[model samples]
Target: MKTKATLLAFLLAAPLWCIAASSYPEQVFQPEIVIYFGDKIGLTDEQREFIVSEVTTAKDSAREDKYRLNVEMAKLRRLLDKTITGEEEAEKQIKRLFEVENALKMANLKLLIRVKNQLSVEQRKQLRELMKDFNPKKIGPSEEVEKRLQAKIEKLKKGMREMVEIGVNPENISKVTAKFQPLINAAKYKEAEEVLDQAIKMLDDPF
Candidate 1:
């Protein structure tokens, strides 16, 4: 009975584990982090321009890969739904899905690496110091803080909905909010606020 309970618990939590695993690794520096703290970090004009350019190019390039990934995922789901799938075909689809995901991951890593290379050691240190405040482990369970963050998230969601209603691309809004949800779920409220702020700014002035 205990073993069965453990197995059931694992099955129930599997999707959450997968989501946490697939999210941007905490150690990796997102371009939004640099952009948000640019003034405090004293980012040079050149550094800022390079980071933005690389991130923009990466997002554009990943669009096709993202589409392919979605299609592959759908194909795999359909295959799994069938009672007697061809093992070889199922394996091929899984491999293709992994390849697309890997390509997207590699492109993002390369972009971040280039951005990091552009920053001076002192600037990087400054960013690290600024980011310390958002570290989930360091934050206390303050009710006030939790309420504020939750309110901000709700407001942002409303704004995003409004944008979509006014013809803004829903996919663009979704891409930004995707990371935000996981952070919020993990009680990384400070980081979630930062992400939502940056997402709103990006959607408002996408150029």
Candidate 2:
């Protein structure tokens, strides 16, 4: 009974674990990556068509598997909710859920393998190089934000130096400017902008 309960708990938590795991993009070659860099990688028209067809088929299969998974999860919930559920029946449902999840993962793996096999050696090498520089966080705001933040910091630093040269207290400027890099690194643009504005205001009204 203890073992069955433990198994049940693990199975119940499995979906949440999968969801979290899926948040990170797989490092392996995927169809979307090929399509996105098709020109750069010199993908042939035939190769592009093949990849698109495979992706379409895989997406269809995944949709069906996801539907089946949701239905099985609902059934498991119903079984556990009953006042006199049998341990054996719950175990059976959990096993079915596990199988569906495994099938979904397998289908995705097959799709990725197919995509990888279709690419030429040189294209694959180029893709590998591209992937090396692929930081997911660099997807948005990009270099523009970094440039703007750097410019702001430089301006703040120059202002602080000038104020210090003139015998103004540097404590408040130091405290606020110290926060600029961290906020920028964390991509907290709004907070960083506010802090920048505050620094600018301080520099303007250093009294």
Candidate 3:
């Protein structure tokens, strides 16, 4: 009877322990990254081009304002850490920090608002579908699919680096989408799908 009770306890607890061990916080919020509208939408080729260009413009402008604010905040933090003996000086620094933080918050909000304005309802739904993470570990990456995905990822990284260096938005995300369309149409959709995933990840990268 004691042995039977022990076995029942082990059986009941094993699945619960497995689930607890695997559960983890998957969502992370990072403000500096540009989470693209394309990340959420199933864009028509034309829409992708227009949206990408619009977002790139908004983001570049936002980045300039954000950089200055960040510098000021860093200075304020340094001042706080120093040996400040006077209440007047401490109060001034605190005020400056709050002002800078508020400005940064507003700048980010404006950018998000602008991005939202550009997206249509259908596009928004598509974006949600695209942004979902595909866990290859659970889904099992086929060797052929993996190879194609890597190629697509490399291409996207190159394009992103070039955009940053040359200060040019890919005139249209449609161009990139069009470039992939043939491959997708040919039934090599895994590669194109994987490339689209890579593009979203690149846009999300903090740096």
Which model scores highest in lDDT?
2
Error of 2 at 204 (Å): 56
lDDT for every model? Answer: 0.68, 0.74, 0.49
RMSD versus native structure for model 3: 16.5
lDDT of 2 by residue, 6-48 (tens): 6457766666325432344544576666666676888887787
Q: Is candidate 1 or candidate 3 better by TM-score?
A: 1
Clashes of 3: 6
Model 2 residue-pair collision total: 0
Clashing pairs in 2: none
Predicted candidate 1 versus true structure: per-residue lDDT over 16-104, tens digit per residue:
21233126654446676776666678876677667777876888998988788778877877776676667799789878877887787
Clashing residue pairs for model 3:
40-126, 40-127, 40-128, 41-126, 41-127, 42-126
**Winner of 1 and 2 under TM-score:** 2
Which is the better candidate, 1 or 3, if ranked by lDDT?
A: 1
